[model samples]
Target: MKKMRERTRLIIQLAFAALTNGYVSGFLGQKLYKGKLKQFCLPGLNCYSCPGALGSCPIGALQAVAGDRSFSFSFYVMGCLVMLGALIGRLVCGFLCPFGLVQDLMYKIPVPKVLRKIPGDRYLRFLKYIILVLMVLVLPDRVTNIIGQGDPWFCKWICPSGTLLGGVPQVLSTPALQASLGFLFSWKMGILILVLALSSVNYRPFCKYLCPLGAIYGLCNPVSLYHLEVDKEKCTRCGACSRACGMGVDVPKAPNSPECIRCGKCASVCPHDALQFRFVHRKKEKHGQAENIEN
Candidate 1:
């Protein structure tokens, strides 16, 4: 059953990836899709610079609005993202993101996993929120040049997704881009390589510890309409759900934990049928906390 759920999730991930990046001619021409559809935002973290991307990435769009000329806030970007997040929360990370699919595929490579859980992982999880604040929010608003145009700090300096999906392909396919490649490209490439290596050993390292988009969606998990509900009456408190969770969420105890991606592994593994994803919250009893087995 767990395998079936995983397979289904994989299919959804692929479908979303294709739907967002379906522009074949863009890749053929080695140029980004300069289309009208780029006006909109995708629910997951995709690269705006990806040659085939049909729509703007939410984080990229948000940063652009925050940092560009007017330097004003964008209700359009924020409102759209928040509304999408309210519907499914970090389910975007689990089954919709392009880079997430890459990480999932990398983790499947049999390499005798060396780092399933990072040391001090609980502290490490806080890194994404810090990136969200400093790189995404703070730096974009504060740091600017004479014209007062702030660069997209997160995309330029941090996002492995852009490096992989955009930088690599664009550089490889375009001679002008290749000639113009400098330290920034090398730096992002290093980050992408490091992330790929880590993904082979750790499941969704970027999603778990680096993605600002995940951090935003995670914040919505507690109040999202689609959320996990643990049936206290049915739960045996065996820690089965926690054991099965790839994101290290202690499911029975904190069903709507901010870190949860709603991957449904907990739902698939709950032996007593204790945990499930619900559209509406049901009655939950106060109970003993489940230890984070994977953490």
Candidate 2:
């Protein structure tokens, strides 16, 4: 049953990745689609400038609107983000993101994996929020060139996904693009290489530490409709769920923590059937009852 569930997830991931970048002719002919559909944003971390990409990336679109001096804010982009976050939270990272799929595949490369946490791992996870706030939002909105134009700082300076899925393909397909490549491209390539290397050893180093989109979605995990619940009455605290968790969550303590991606790995591994995926309209009545009694 577990294997079947995992296979289904892989199929879904592959299908979504293909659908998002379905312009196969673009890869063959070295062209990009500049149609009306490009105006819309994809929910995942796909690059808008990817050769085969049919829609704009949400982060890229958000940065574009934020960086535009004429526009003070982007209600449409903000609304989309909030709605998606509230609806699915970081399940998008687990099941939908093309980059997350890539990282998951990399981790399966049969290498002697580093199965231990990095030093300061807990604190380092907060870096993505910092990146989202400063690089994605603040700098882009507040700082601009002399001409009142600001760049997508995250896309330009960071975002290995863009470099991998967009820049590399474009540069490979177009001879003219090769000569125009400069230090920025080299820097982005380096970052991509580092991320790819670390992903092979660690489980989702980029998702855990650097993905701004993940950071945004993670904030909504606790209150999102799709959530994980732990049944304390059934739980034996054997720690199987924690051992199965690649994200290092304390499953019994905080089943639906902000860092949780709602991947269902904990629920799958729980022998006692303590963990479950469910919609909780409010705090569990049992927890409230316990708190009242304790008080």
- Model 2 residue runs over 4 Å out of place are 280-295
lDDT per residue (tens digit) for residues 87-136 in model 1:
98888888899999999999999998789899989999999999988888
Worst 10 residues of 1 by lDDT: 286-295
Check candidate 1 and list the clashing pairs.
none
**Superposed Cα deviation of residue 129, candidate 1 (Å):** 1.0
Candidate 1 Cα outliers beyond 4 Å, as residue runs: 283-295
Query: What CA RMSD would candidate 2 show?
Result: 2.8
- The Cα local distance difference test for each model comes to 0.86, 0.85
lDDT, candidate 1, at 171: 84
lDDT by residue (tens digit), candidate 2, 21-51: 9998888887888889988888889998898
For candidate 1, the lDDT comes to 0.86
